[model samples]
Target: MEPVSPDRVSDAPDDRFDQSVEALIFASDVPLRDEDVARAIGEVTGADTTLEDIVAAVERLNAAYRATGRAFRVEQWGGGYRLATIPEQAGVVRALFEQEAEKRLSRSLLETLAVIAYKQPVTKPEIEHVRGVGADYALRQLMERGFVDVVGRADAIGRPLLYGTTDRFLDQFGLGDLSDLPTPREVEEILADPRFSRERAQLLAEWAADNQPPPPPADSSEPVGTRLRVVVSSDSPPTPSEADDADG
Candidate 1:
């Protein structure tokens, strides 16, 4: 914030500045950068707004939101500021935009993503070596989902492309930056959770159920879920009295 000259030292400029910052952050679909806000407001107001000023204005706005019990507030993530719903409203937000089944990542994708997030700027071959599988499909899906991007090319024999997590990845996962990623040891602790293994078993069960062949269709037109009954006939012969009665 620059020192105001005597003519314009009233509360209107400060109020308008705060309002302008709020409008910019509200209008941006993605995270809004403080520098962008400062530049835009500076050009509009002829006031040299600094990043610190933008930050302070955001704080004031957030304090207002808290005071008013708003459902959302501005949050700093992925190197920029974005409006984020409060944690208590998370359930409603998720319900409004439920994740589709097709978007669900399989175990292989999770493993590959973890490897890339932890050892980013790494090559496909290195990822494969760690995961013991080809990374072509995983890399393709991650790139398609805007989670991973090619940072550079490795200086190996072929100069393979290097992959790293994108800012979208950080924003999607609620991470401020790569530093927010859990360490390998922490991941190990998560893997050791009994619930994780149980969920793995559940996935296997669902896969087995999906891949199993359908039962042979019944010729009879019995309704679905109805029990079937089988009656067996005796094949043994009768005694001599039954034979004589048959002859008579």
Candidate 2:
């Protein structure tokens, strides 16, 4: 058997490489890493395809798409390459999905998801504490929807399960990574919107209610009549004799 030569590997036509890479990218539901693309091409073509080759092929494919004004392009996101609609087409794309968007997660689910996304590797108790409500149902719903996942256990007592946003979450929201999440100002703007203000108010109210200290326990030992009299504050200033009697 003859050993494959480097020259023979380089002889593979660039267009063929580009086409192979394009096919893989188009077929993949998730992002394909450069190395993964190269490996797939090598397996199919029986050639040593390097990462550099895959990168060059992807560049050429994107260049062609730009020249032809394609509605979509392959982009590197979350450390992998995936096909996505170009930014210019976002308006129409969003309009097309408007009906489906209406059926999306409820405000409560979104609030729970926001807590998990921003404070990842967080536990359910921490999530509940932040939202001031039980998160069992929300967390289960998120997990079922393939957005949030149990990444690991926290170090605190019970080593409670720690949850984080999944890659699917990024894809669903058109985010490249966690860094692409809205900034503080953007979040404020979203909260300020009339549609979301009510939900925001509810969250704040819940948090406030949860953090408020419980009322002081009733003075069981004190006489009820005396307690009632002492609890009432009079407009008239207490006389010296009255103050002395109270102190006594």
Candidate 3:
């Protein structure tokens, strides 16, 4: 008799398990875990399958696809393996989605995000201290935008809610870690520009106008358009030559 064909011998239950794994990976929204693959295969095959077997099958599949230059491949993400299109194809996929579906943070929102990102596990009061203004509105905007999250509570009295940036934040900012933030001096230099500060203030005003509660009426008992301005510091002393010229 002719030697048994490898193809004939390969058409066994394990082969069927491999196919089921592929299907589950394709259907997952995010990367599926090893246990997920095994559980899915077991459910379909009516036989117990180990994650190790599933992992070996997935590895073979990924290697085959990679060797064949397939447009899609299996990848490990979020502690799970899943089939995903190659990264090069993502631009085309992104183009098909509605532009409005994309989220964007306003300047104040970005600044607030940066602050929380750098000082993560920080409280709202800490944020206000850095900004020198109430950040309640900005915090709400960040929360709505999905950039910042309430990680936990502070250990201090009153147990204020502590906020931190999310994985989405890392994805959006293209940063692998928070340590990439600029130093305090660098941040101060960036914010010291008159134009930059003015633009930032304008952006904050616009964000507040769009999201925050309406301002109190001018007829309210409290005076309106009458904020008391106090001189903080004098400019550098006039140059000696200029002072002498003025005196002359």
lDDT of 1 by residue, 85-200 (tens): 89998677777788443246789888998999998888999999998889999999999999899999988898899999999988887787888886566777789998887786
User: Which is better, 2 or 3, measured by lDDT?
Assistant: 2
Which segments of model 2 are wrong by more than 4 Å?
1-13, 44-56, 77-79, 85-103, 183-248
Steric overlap count per candidate = 0, 0, 1
> RMSD to native for every prediction?
15.4, 13.5, 12.2
Best by TM-score: 1
lDDT of 3 by residue, 38-117 (tens): 67666766677786777777776776677678888776643566566787887776778745454556787777777898
Better of 1 and 2 by lDDT: 1
TM-score of 2: 0.58
Specify the poorest-scoring 10-residue window by lDDT in model 3.
225-234
What is the Cα-based lDDT of residue 180 in candidate 2? Answer: 89
Provide the lDDT at 8 for model 1. Answer: 41
CA lDDT scores, all candidates in order = 0.80, 0.79, 0.71
